[model samples]
Target: MQSTVNYLWHTDDLLGQGATASVYKARNKKSGELVAVKVFNTASYLRPHEVQVREFEVLRKLNHQNIVKLFAVEETGGSRQKVLVMEYCSSGSLLSVLESPENAFGLPEEEFLVVLRCVVAGMNHLRENGIVHRDIKPGNIMRLMGEEGQSIYKLTDFGAARELDDDEKFVSVYGTEEYLHPDMYERAVLRKPQQKTFGVTVDLWSIGVTLYHAATGSLPFIPFGGPRRNKEMMYRITTEKPAGAIAGAQRRENGPLEWSYSLPVTCRLSVGLQTQLVPILANILEVEQAKCWGFDQFFAETSDILQRVVVHVFSLSQAVLHHVYIHAHNTIAIFLEAVYEQTQVAPQHQEYLFEGHLCILEPSLSAQHIAHTTTSSPLTLLSTASETPKGLAFRDPAQDIPKFFPKVDLQSDYTTSKVRGGAGGSNHKTPQISQKPARLSQRCHTPNVVVGLCLPIPQPCPFSVLPWRFSSVSGTPEIEEVKRVTELKSRLRALAEALSRCSHRITETQLRLSNLSSELLKNRDQVHADRSIQKIQCCLDKMNLIYKQFKKSKMRPGLGYNEEQIHKLDKVNFSRLAKRLLKVFQEKCVQKYQTSLVTHGMWMREVHETRNHLRMVSCSMAAHNTEAQGVQESLSKILDRLSNQLLQDRAKEAQVSPSPAAPYPSPALTDLVFHMQELCNEMKLLAFDLQDNNRIIEGLNTPPSGS
Candidate 1:
């Protein structure tokens, strides 16, 4: 071993001694780097060769950030002794720190964080790399002091490390007694001595114990003494309260150890500077691992909080504006067109105005049409044509307007009438009044003067004013119609707004659900992979047990069966039964392993699908929310416009002269308003329902326990 060490290093300084090996601080002559050399005392153990081989195999393959680096191995003359070269840590073991007079009691918060972080990081790294540091304790961890006085921790000692698959029975109890899990002790007591099996969860348990020690400056379960007392304390660790409770109990019994006699004074000073220490410590000391702030839960909670913060930061007002503009524009156009059509106008003029901007038309019309038709003037000619026959006669010049005129001719007969009145006097002069037709013609031809007679004006009918009054009344209905249309539009807009908001919320929730599912799957896959390794290990353990039994039989001459007898026994039916039993057990193990794999795979797939579905739903919800927001804005705008128009219409009605013939208000406007409100309410309810469903789906997608 000395010669082998010489070959790997220039010089070695003895640092510590153990029952099985002597540890030396050495400088690698070839690389000019410091390294620790552990030389095994081969002669001290019963199966030294096997132990050395096992340790070497495990250490060579085990590579983790927290674990000590195994550089090389050397064999001595006659292959009797073996030396292992590893990375050197100058700060020595955690055991040294704990034993120091300045830190004998406990480390403060800041110092504890550093220690815990390093240790957990190392352990997590090991687990990630499929290695378990079965013997984690203060002695196995080395703290390296840097030039700047900062300390770096490294996990050491793989002498007791076993590959997860190695089936060799570890009859000799390993690991520090106080940190051993309860199952280890139980397995040791079983009659058949069932092989001990453990996974990465054991490392976490050790970490919990280590944390307790760091906090209290004493092993959580162990009382001061030697290995024997430590063993008794381990029994209590397995059977008693959690690590924190144990530490607390010990602290109470020992009284407060002073800083000078325990941990460094700087540790306490550093802890006092931080306000978050108390809550952090409480979380770390939680009894239930599930409840503790582990990686899974921490990430999940952080993500949720961040999402909410982001939503709060970004305003959603723009969505509302867009909806309001659209709704108002549409409603106003429709009302204007309806009002224009109600006025008495020529068909051609009505068409012209309909095509023009006199009314807001449907969106599809050409700009040219809008320019031509919209006008405020009423068609008085058409109104008069419909209201009176006299107006129609003027409209049609060829009609009989002369039928109301009288046909009268008075010219030559007037002179005859004068002669008759003076008949008595003219009797004597009648013979002198005779005249010829030619003479009369000549008299008439001398330009006769005709006088025009004015016809008496007809009396005014009471109902003649009705048409004008009706026109005034019609104006009221037009305003009412506009108001109603606006109200309906407003309600529709509100409904849309509500839906949009709900949709947005749903979308966010779905995203969170998806992430949760992914994490859950990853965790399950890890667990399944671990189980596969365990099944193989179990099979090998069964084989080893058989080998040990066979070896025992061979060592006892009387107990051993004769070669001929053994051959005969192998030929017997019992041998076949034994072989069958082995095959069955092997199959059973394989089946169990396969079943677990399949179950986890299916579960992961289901979780992924469910999350994806939830995400889609959330997206839908977000869209709905956006729509709802728009609807709400539109509704508000429409209502405002409707109210304003109604007020204006009422004002216009008040200004118009009221007559008995005035038209009544149209009820369509009121009905439209009522319908719109009902629609808006229904939409709001639908959006709310959608939001609720999305929330429920998100909840379902989250992992029941882990996250």
Candidate 2:
């Protein structure tokens, strides 16, 4: 029979081909949106109706952002084949992306994080929506590219999806060979023997395999060939050692040359990227499902790594853009050579001023006399003086010379002088000439003097061109004091919160204790009632045995004697029997009397012990009750103190305003208050029940008298 479809869309361009279906790029005429049409071949071994029904049942209920959307399904006319219309992804499958030259065999670490996050997000969506994509691989995932260079990943292939129901059992072995779970492969290998039940963990296993393949561009485990050959692989997967162990074993067997690299791509990544990437990949590809991180956990970790990468890249770009060089020493000196040179003064004058010493040179003074003068007075002069017959003549001197010359104060201009005739003198006359004392100021040349300025350097202004100068002034001490106070306040708040939580937990524990006491009382009552019933049953059995003996005696009749003879014989026998019975009864009475005495003694002892135990329990209960009451009162007082403290802190905080803002109460406080209230209610209920139980127990102990 020829099937008919509405022909909503058609495309001649084949997008991809799977095992049972061929996908084509098409456009929905009504919606005018591009869509992928997946056509199932009717000529395949699978029954068309069964496949369509199964696919429809799963796809109709699935609704998630990550899972592919199924728009419509129809039967085509000529081939009688079922077709699925799905959303068309523009960027195509992840498999194609990984295989592309742009990605270079595998994605870079940063881009890998992005792709991994997408995959995990999709898997998490599927998990949350009670669906497990049994075949989660790069080929089954499509990435849609937006105009802003953003990508959206969608998980496709609903034909392998299954619902997550606790009671439901899945036995069908269907999935790609490369991504099949060990359990599924086991079931397939043992198909003729017995069927095995597997849960959604199989999907996790498959996801692990898919993640391994995605990361390394190769499967973690590979079979030789075919289903029978795959059995050996499954056994290896289930029973053999891990990948690390296998690699180690291979190395041991071949002495390291067996695993040696033949070329550069023998190991796809460099030594460093591999060391970091391999462990991360191993965590996702763990054989144990429970040990492996779930979709959400994986995505959360992956997103964190991605954020770290983004921050790192941003930091690198910032470094490159700013291109600032930092130096420990002052480089500003290179730009201010003129200013620095202006500050440089001669060191000789500085030494003279600081050391309080001077040097002088006179033409007539000898070197020995100059050294002697330096030893006597610190102002030393090295010069030579010419002596005439009557007086000494001096060279040119300034007007202020005489005022500073203390030694020459006695010498006056009217003093007798001697004229020297060293050059040419026709008549040698004794002319007296007075020699002027050397002035202290004439000892040193003042023109060559240098003075060192000791003035402090001017600080840079706020708006100055100095790079290290601050733009605004701050009261640092005040800010620090405020921060310290804030920290103290936060710690106090935390302490109060902790105290409140402890009080709540104590109340809850008290409530639970009271409930347990009540339950213990009820159990004791039931045990007592059951014991009484057992005793009554034993008594009834004894009475039944006595009645059966009486019935047996009444059925016997005299066989061989007259009435008088029988009566006399019966009387004689009765007398003898009465005597023997009396003796036996007396023995029994004595035995019973002894037994009663022992029983009475035991009962008295039991009563005394019970009384003592009850007293001890009462005392203990009283002590415990007192302690609990004290604790409750103490907690109430502590809570009140905390409340008062909190109010005072709030007031103090309000008075001394914060720079930014005061932190608000944590949202956890509301939950704490609610829990505290609930605990108080529960404690009240438990206390009432405990009181009732104590009363019931008291009543059970007090027996009725004169019954």
Candidate 3:
């Protein structure tokens, strides 16, 4: 069917083709993200309208990690075409892996089990919602690559799936011949009674077959490819046990799991997996549909797998399943009381059954209720108008409850049959479950099986026996207080690392500010030295001028040849070499003052940068900020003292020489030197105070010992 979808999706090359749809590698135009597009040739479908609509209804309702997500749907009116935009699985389907010649050596058991559990988890969710994927085969299961050498498997191809009402059954068999349940095949192909149909348990049979094939590298049953041979194969599926087919069927190492009456089986499952799996296969592959393990039962029993399939239950209604995993052995009554209080149900009339049937009140005898994954404990509870039931129960063992095997301890003889299997070969079927479905019937209104899984806890069940029943582990418990505490510790360490980064930044800011303040002090001291040099130069100039006057007095009528004047001039005059030294010192002092001014500006820039950063780190860090303020106040006081001293020095200079051109006499020069020395002493004290401030800042910058 040719059509254009929304401008948002850009269709690319075809990825793969299926029976009713063609999958393409596409990109979301808005996000540039890759996605898989399943385009349906609605005109070519067996029940085109029903298939298209049913898939849409089913995908929209389901939301799970193991279930393929349906992002959007598109349809074109003219061409009878429909599109399903979904999450892309790059690695393709499990069927492809099993069939590929490259994987003839077989997949690692670890990788295989992980993928198996993921598929089971998704199937459990499907069963809970009353939906069944009638066609669950290797081809229908897709594998997606995940983080760190892990892979996730999700159930796809819901075209053959449907959600049945409690009274409904899948009488129309529409899947591969090898994967179909015996009951479904008999009714559709053999034209058995239409009323005789199967429930969701059909999917369980397929799961058992799929897992068996994945592990053993061969199907448990012999293939009857043509129409004439199909009848013989169907009979075998109905009568032959899985143990028989596996013992006498075909084998291959690097090809499709081909099995025929003419070949021998090559078992790929490890002993540990075989011990657990063989019994499961024997039970699930049972001819009587009701005798096999239900989907929920399979999930619960497989808990002891290498990759434990943790029970995760989700609900759309307000009904919440709060898990209370108790380690210590306790009375069932305490747990019930706690649940009753938590849900705020009335306290006066509270009657609970520890191990009995659970019934949900309904108008019809065939309406299906929600499915729950129950523990090995056969406990059940009857549903009421209020979902918060008074109690839970276990089935009466005398009648029959499909039993769960104890943890498969496969260290020694895995080939040895399980407890029930070794019980003298009597019909290994649970009579109660085989009787009828767990609907609101007159006789079996509340059966042993619970419909949905919620609040699933494992082993040594606290809700199995009577209110006063105790567990085997009273002192030492089964459940841990907390599993994987190391993960939590790592998160805390990440938080600590973030805090350290913040502290380091603050320390760096404070250090820069301290360095700037120290540099500013050095500049102020350089200015002081420059002023001293200028005062001494002024003294030398005064002496030179007086010496010139003494020499020029020779032309003066009376004072030209006066010995007294010459003697006085010689006593005050400085040597030529000494004068040259003074001139060079003054020039050096000028350069020093100029360099200090530039440095002082740089110090100001550094302070400005610190001020900008301080806004972020300006938390009232108790001791550090307060100490910084104290140092600032001390610096302010020193600046004030220096300002006063400078003003005093200016007054002294004005008083010592009233005229700018007048030379200072001996007494005046001595007074000027003494005053300048006093000013320099005060400036030296300011420098010392700046050094003290630097030390204080250093103490504040040091990190706490504990940190």
TM-score of each: 0.35, 0.38, 0.40
Regions of model 3 farther than 4 Å from truth? 1-4, 7-12, 44-51, 76-80, 165-168, 187-195, 224-231, 242-266, 306-707
lDDT per residue, candidate 1, 1-707, as tens digits? 25464444423467666678888877665666777888777553656566657777877776765667888887655555678888788878887665442243356444665676677667555544455667777888888876888777878777766554222223444565556555554454322365655544444456556755565455544433322434443344345554323332222333432111122222232222222233333343344444455533333432332222000000010000000001122343432333233332333322111111112233344322222110122111111112211110001111101111121111111111111111211111111111111122112112120000001111111111111222223345444544544454444445445445544544554454445445434544554454433443343344333333333343344432465354234223222332333344345433443443343333324333433544565666566556655665565556566556556756766898764542435244444444545544654555565556545444432322311
lDDT of 2 by residue, 1-707 (tens): 12234334444467788777888877655556777788887544365566557677777777766667888887676665778878889888887665442232245444555566677777776666677667777888888876788777788887767776533567777777656666676556545455666666666667665555455444455333323344554445443535432111121221221221111132233232343344445555455555555655665655544342110000010001000111223232321221122212122211111112322222233323222221112321111111111111222112101111122111110010000101001010001001001111111211221100111111111111112111132354323323432343343334334333433443443344344334434433443343333333333334233323323333344223454344334333323432333343235323332343333233223323433444444444344334434434443443344445456756776798665543334232233333333433433333343344333334323322311
Ranking by TM-score: 3, 2, 1
Sort by lDDT, best first.
3, 1, 2
Best by TM-score: 3
Candidate 2 clashes: the total is 17
lDDT of 2 at 319: 9
Candidate 2 positional error at 198, Å:
2.0
lDDT score, candidate 3: 0.47
Q: Model 2, 30: alpha-carbon shift in Å?
A: 5.0
Q: What is each predicted model's overall lDDT from 0 to 1? A: 0.43, 0.42, 0.47
Error of 1 at 682 (Å): 66
